[model samples]
Target: MEPQKINKGDRNKIYFLVIVIAALIGTNAYLFFKDRQQSERFVTVSTEKDKLRLEVEKIEVELDKVNALNLDLNEKLVEEQKLARVKIEELKAALEKNQITQGELDKANTQINELKTFVKNYNDQIIQLQKDNIFLKNSRDSLQNTLRNISNKASNLENENANLNAKVKTAAALKLQSAEIIAFRTKSSGKKVEVTKSSTAEKLSVRFNVVPNQLAEKGHHNIYLRVFDPAGNLLADEGNHFEADGQDMQFSHSIFINYNNDDSTYVIDWANPKPFIKGIYTVILYADGNTMGKAQVELR
Candidate 1:
């Protein structure tokens, strides 16, 4: 059996329907594939965002560790830390978005790497500062020790000088060898006669010989005399005093003598204003602030 042929208009309509169906299928396929590509890109962006978040967290942990060290930071270092933290916060904010571009993700990654470098440099600076502090402490300790040693040496030298001055003062003092005392009276003819009786005595004479000393100062010497009666009463002049052995003492009289550093005999004559007593009279002599010698005479 043979099939009958269709008309040209019917064939053209069928062809038009087939072409429309093909266009619809092609459009649906393109739309479906485009949706799939968008979904994949979104997933990739999410992964990148997660990776960036992990990097930020890691850097934050590093920062926390460094801060825990409690190092002393300078103003410049503190500012650098602030800037790094701000950058990290910006990165975290960008990653929090549901959508992010490759460019933005790459920018975040680059900033994170910069932060790592900054952290490394900051740690290095802290290490250098610690070393410097240690060196300065050692130097200060050494300087203090040196100053203390110098002060000790100076104190020792001062003590030695004081001792030497004391020795020199002792060596320069003059000494007297012997002393004698005599009582005398002036007669009616004005002739002075030596008397043994205290009732007739009007004046007492004290004589002493100074031992020759080269260390003694030569020129003139002021000799102070302290006379005491047998009753232990000092015959002192009013307001007449002199310094002897680092103490002030009242003296009966003072006389000037020329000392030639040779053994020379000197006499001091003292008149008693009161009546002489029948007892011993004692005399002490001082020169150059020292006791030279003493003498006594018995009056009958």
Candidate 2:
């Protein structure tokens, strides 16, 4: 009976142990399944986070490109604006210079018209004087012819013939009056000078006057005025010519005058129409083969 009881107790103990081991194995299996599910959920979250980070990086790159383009465009705009402003200033300066030149041209035109009118009047007076001289010449010739016929005729009284011949000779001796040239005030002043219209070397205005004499013959005569540099060289070109002392000479410039009265004043203005250098200039007037007057001036 003792052996049988021992066997029963051992079997009961083995069975109880087996039951406890099985319970532990089941709990471990449940815990392992729960852990695996949690791991899968964490992996999905990490993948989503990586995708979001990549998208943000791409957007940042695009923004940087846009900012670079904007900067380039702004720089180009500034350069163009600067170029426009510079052009505007240049145009303004050119316009102002043109205005000044136009004004000067107008004034020159007016003076030239006045000079033309004076020349026309002088020519008319000369024509009238020529007519008077022709009549006088015809009268003198007729009187001389009559005296010659009377002297040849022996029938005429001798004393009367001699007296008439003497009168005829005296009348034939009379001739047209001679012309005189008036001198300038500055002829004795030995100075050389130049005159310019502007300081910028754009143009020059030259002016001079001529005097008339009544004792001169009523005829068309050429007057010459020569402009010279400080070096005593003629400033005018070769085409100009005038009559001086009953001879024709190549001059710088000349004007025609009909002497009808004494103290006739004449003025002439010349346009340089070219650039000039800084220096002194001299002016000389010649008429009837004589130097009538001179003037001098300076320019800087």
Best by lDDT: 1
TM-score of each: 0.59, 0.30
Please report, in order, the local distance difference test score of every candidate based on alpha carbons.
0.88, 0.52
lDDT of 1 by residue, 35-103 (tens): 999999988888888887998998888878778878777899888888888988988998898777899
> Which residue window of length 10 is worst by lDDT in model 1?
165-174
Best by TM-score: 1
Deviating ranges (above 4 Å) for candidate 1: 1-141
